[model samples]
Target: MVNIQKLRFFDCNCSVGRVAYPHLSDIPDVEGLLKEMGRAGIEEAMVYHTVARYGHPPAGNALLTEAIKNNPRLHPVWVLLPHHTGEMPHPGRLLPEMEKHHVGAARLYPGANYHNFSLSEWCSGELLGALEEAHIPLIVDMDTVSWEDVYKILDNHKQLPVITATCTYRNNRYIYPLLEKYDNLFVELSRFMGAGTIEDMVERFGSHHLLFGTNMPQYTGTAAVSLLTYSAIDRTAKQAIAGENLGNLLKEAWK
Candidate 1:
């Protein structure tokens, strides 16, 4: 058995600050978040702010930058929106700010509950096109958007690295086809709890596209860590899913 500690975990799905409905394990500050990461043996995390999701993107994105200013381990994943309404920056300006802040990844909340926006080519083509051009990794939750929309985004932006997180377990039907189709598409591994699911994915889709993510605050890292630790795959595959895959994605972004 490989020691869990040896796997350098880099969480792709995590958030900080108090939300409207706070989770029982929610950590509202960076100190507590860092401590939790240490407890779970997580070396780094791509974190966003609650305000960014539920509140305005500009203010929330700025708050995220300030909150995680000096912490290299806690990478900021800024919440972005359509540039049509002037609520957020256009691609030309947004890329520079991302570079300045050293943001590792970007996310979109194009749902009724959060930012109400369209993900179609006509609506988000400019922004999505820029992200693809820059090689920035875009993270989207499956619950927030329909599978059809996900397909459209992938089909349109072929080279854009997109990570789909927080999908329900029934997602195999919808997700499997996507994994098979899009080389730029990836899935976050926190919720794939079916026995031998990870092993099957590694065998079929290759381990490079499956990322390790702990839906922190709402969940703990222990289960996620164990999921990869005890998976019926080789050590090299486990390590790649744990952090290397995400690290490579971040490295490819225009820093």
Candidate 2:
């Protein structure tokens, strides 16, 4: 059996608040989430509000920011919208909120939540420009984002770091090329349960290009943890994928 008693993991993608679907099991709130993290051995995470993805960004972001206050282990990821409506904050006023909430990252979920805007340059160019300037990490899930749009965004904003989430083995056809083209791109590795593919990815791209994440509550963190724990990669590579890469990326955002 594989053991990871000493591994320190930092989960790069996670969410709180209730999802719109009632058929799914309930996800934990702040207190409960901490308990789940403790059990899973995930030392820290970059968490977004579940409502932020599907509902009002400010409301959910406020709730999440306040909930994790003074708790360094739970980092907040604010959801950003085009601000075409008066509901969300514009890029002009993001820095203060980020400072207040200690947020170093943001995400876009237009399609996931039924929002009717594009992440195209003409739509959110200013917001993307500001985030790129600040060096904040932007996470987009494969379920909601199109790779064609991702390519356009990456092509325009070469310096912005983007972390693609919830990818599976089938995504490699385009994903590998994106990785090669963009040094600033990082992949979240929990949903991509490709067995030995972890070793293959580490060999093709350095271990620093991947970050540990679990779609926790939706899936068991243990399953993903076990995969990494048993991989043929060396301890140094495993540790980097587990947490070090994420830690370094977070530091860069604040820098």
lDDT of 1 by residue, 1-255 (tens): 774448999999988887778657657888888887888889999999889988888888888988988888999999898789888788999888888888878899889888988899888889999899989999998879888988998999998999998865668888889888999988998887877788888999889999999888667888899889989999999999999999999999994
Candidate 2 residue-wise lDDT, 1-255, digit = tens: 995357898898888888767436676587767777777878888898877778877888888887778888889999888866867677778666786667978898868445668888888898888888888988988889888878878888988888888988778777789988988888888778776778888899889888899877566677778778888999999999999988887787755
Candidate 1 residue runs with Cα over 4 Å from true position: 1-5
List the candidates' TM-scores in order: 0.96, 0.93
Give candidate 2 misplaced runs (Cα > 4 Å): 1-5, 22-24
RMSD in angstroms between candidate 2 and the native structure over all alpha carbons: 2.0
What C-alpha lDDT do the candidate models reach, one value each? 0.88, 0.82
